[model samples]
Every structure is written in C-alpha cells, then in structure tokens.
Target: MSLGLAGVCLALVTAAGATSGSVVFVPVLSFTLAWTHSIEKVRWEEDYVVRPGKTPGAAPVLEAVAARVRGSGAGMEPPPDARLRHGWYEYTPTLRHPAELRLTRSGFTADYDWCTGGRCRSMAGLLPSNGGVTVLTACRSAPP
Candidate 1:
C-alpha cells in the first residue's frame, strides 16, 4: 500500500520535471520510480561533448555542474520506502538565465542557451574552481 502511494508521488514528480523541460535531480529511490513510470532519465553527464566552438569544455562543465549538485545537497537521500523506491536522476534546469543542462543515467546530454542582462550568453557552465563537490549518501541497503 505504502509502496503504491510512493510510486504515484514519484510519477508525478518525474512527469512534472519532464514536462517542465528542466533538469531535476532526485534521490535513488525516486529515480528508480521514474524508470518504473517510464520517464527516461537524461545522461547529460556523459553524452556532452565540447563542441569545437563552444566556450567551455563539456566535460569540465558537466563535472562542475555535478559538483554543484553534489554540493547543493539537493535530493541527497533516498526517500523512505513509504515514499518511493531507491535510485537517482539528473536533468537540465528550466531557466533562461542559466542554460539548462541535463544528464540521464544512460549518459544522454542536453544543453540550452540563455540570455543575461540583454546580452545572450551561456550561464556559467560549471562551478568555479573554488566550489566544492556535493557528497551523495550511499544507498543504505547496498553493500559497502
């Protein structure tokens, strides 16, 4: 019963993120639910390649964003079983200021451009060298 309710919540969240066209990061359980719900996770992390003319390297930008997400502590823990199953997801953001970047579990990547102060420019692609990476908590039931 609880699992069912959790599944429903997970579906709603994943749908919301997908339809909104923004990257969303969720804990492992919610990610698993997204898959069960048929919402594909984008792999922006691995698929992104630095285009010849692109400003910043794709790898560095992704690493920076991943670091930022990790540091932000957003969706760090898997929700209780009563809330959802275990898995994690990454997607692009939906803002115009900072380009939306997405990464799925399968290594898909999506990039969007944005405008700033009247000038069109890609938002800071990654965290500055000073920004630290977020530490994700391990799955409780997983083997260490």
Candidate 2:
C-alpha cells in the first residue's frame, strides 16, 4: 500500500464500537505519544513513524523509533543503554508494526497525550468522553 501523499487516518473508537474522533495526517509521517505513569508520576514519551505498507491493500506500517522517560524508578526504569540527556532517559524501544494503542479511561490519572506538527493535546480533549476503552489505530486516509 503506497500511500504517497494520501497520508494516514487515525481513528479513536470506543470499546462499544462507536467512533469518538479522528484525525488525518497528510503525507504519512511521524507522531509522539506522551503520558504520565500512574504510580511513578514520571512523564514518558514514545516517538512513532508511519509509512506505506509493503503490499497492496495492506495496513499502514507503524514503527516506534525512540522512547524517553523522565526520572526513572519503580515502573520507569530506562534501558541499560539509555542515555541521560536534558534530564530525560532516552532509548530506542522494540515494537511490532501496525500498533494499536488501547487507552483506558480510568479517570484516576492524566490522559494520554498525542503530539504532532508541533502541537500536543490530551486524548480526552481530542475525543468524546465515554469512560471506556478507546482504541487508536492508523488507516489509509480518504482521498479528497
């Protein structure tokens, strides 16, 4: 699936199969996901890149390039090869393609943050509040 300039469409759907929100990023590209650990209270971020699939009719490829965690301890341990720079422990994380992010709305912690094109916004603010599980996935954007 060669997207070319078609870009990618990200959909946020609730567990009950209702579409909450969606966004289209032109020219298939990269984005960052940030969130605070519930127990550790440390901020973590993952950088992901989206590209055309290897075959026709295939889903878009998703790859996480790097991850950064601020103040590691407890559930926030950085990898051994992680470098400490600017108060952040940075390292590349191993991930499988076609990643589907399942976000839980527990209302007990901060919502996940999505950043793209120099802007950042919480998932709660981006989508409708349903107090349920929300699945975030990438698909081919409709041609205009």
Candidate 3:
C-alpha cells in the first residue's frame, strides 16, 4: 500500500462519498497546492504548546531556527538587535526604529509605526495558528 500524503488524501476523498466529497477534496487539494511556495531552509516540527503568558521557542526545534539565523544575511551588513528572552526572540531592525519582529515558540508578532506624522500609529495581531513552517521534500522510495 503506497499510502503517501496524496494517497492518504485520495483515500479520504473516496470514503467521504459523493455528497460531501467536494469538501474533503478542497482542503486536500490546498495541501497539494503548497508546493508552489518557497521551502524554508530549516524546519520546525512538533512545536511545544506553552500556556498563555508563558514564553515560546523552548522546544528543541528552536535549535534549528537559531542555527539558520546565524549564517543568514551575513556580511558587512549591520546585525539586527536580537534578544532571546523568555523563550521568544525579538529582533529590532535598527536603533531607534519603531519596529520589531518577535518570534515566540507559539508564533510571531510584527509591530511597527506606519508614519511619524500626527496620524502615526502602531499595530499588532495575534496569529491564528502558531505552528511554524515545516519543509517537506519528496519522500524517497524504500530500498528494493
């Protein structure tokens, strides 16, 4: 039984019968469509679930994220103000900048000032799903 990702989806679609089959097909198809996007260099899987107000990024998967960050964007370029605190990483792009990207074990936050005028404002939003990306390659066949 070659039950790979697509195979598993097909089996589910078949089991759903004709009436609600379209519903199942749509979501499975979306997963297939994910191939179009860039695969991040590193991967984070089986992320830990921390309680509200607790810090994130303490999972072992975070080691991969940290390693990927080191060699990335290397050069004479200035390094961002990066802090690993309470299991979350906060990166301020520059000094006195009204912007920061914070990645916790649970998710990420982007806060910044839109403008300096009297109407200037700041904004942030919580993530719907905190799961970080996991890069999947084509699974290889078992040795014959």
Candidate number with greatest lDDT: 2
TM-score of candidate 1 to 2 decimals: 0.15
Tell me the TM-score of each prediction against the true structure. 0.15, 0.77, 0.15
The sequence of per-residue lDDT tens digits that candidate 3 reaches over residues 31-97 is 1110101233321111111111123322111111121021223232224555545443334323221
lDDT of 2 by residue, 1-144 (tens): 343453445455666677666553435478888988888889999988876677876767677788999987775589888999999999988664646766676677787887888888886656644566666566666544
* Local accuracy of candidate 1 as per-residue lDDT tens digits, 1-144: 111111101111132343322222222221111111113332111112111213432211111111111111333432232121133333433321222233222222222222223333222232111121211111122112
Q: Of models 1 and 2, which has the larger TM-score? A: 2
Q: Pick the candidate with the highest TM-score.
A: 2
* C-alpha lDDT of residue 66 in model 1: 17
Counting clashing residue pairs in each candidate, in order, gives 23, 1, 2
CA lDDT of each candidate? 0.21, 0.72, 0.21
lDDT of 2 at 25: 43
Whole-model lDDT for model 2 versus the true structure?
A: 0.72
Error of 2 at 141 (Å): 2.1
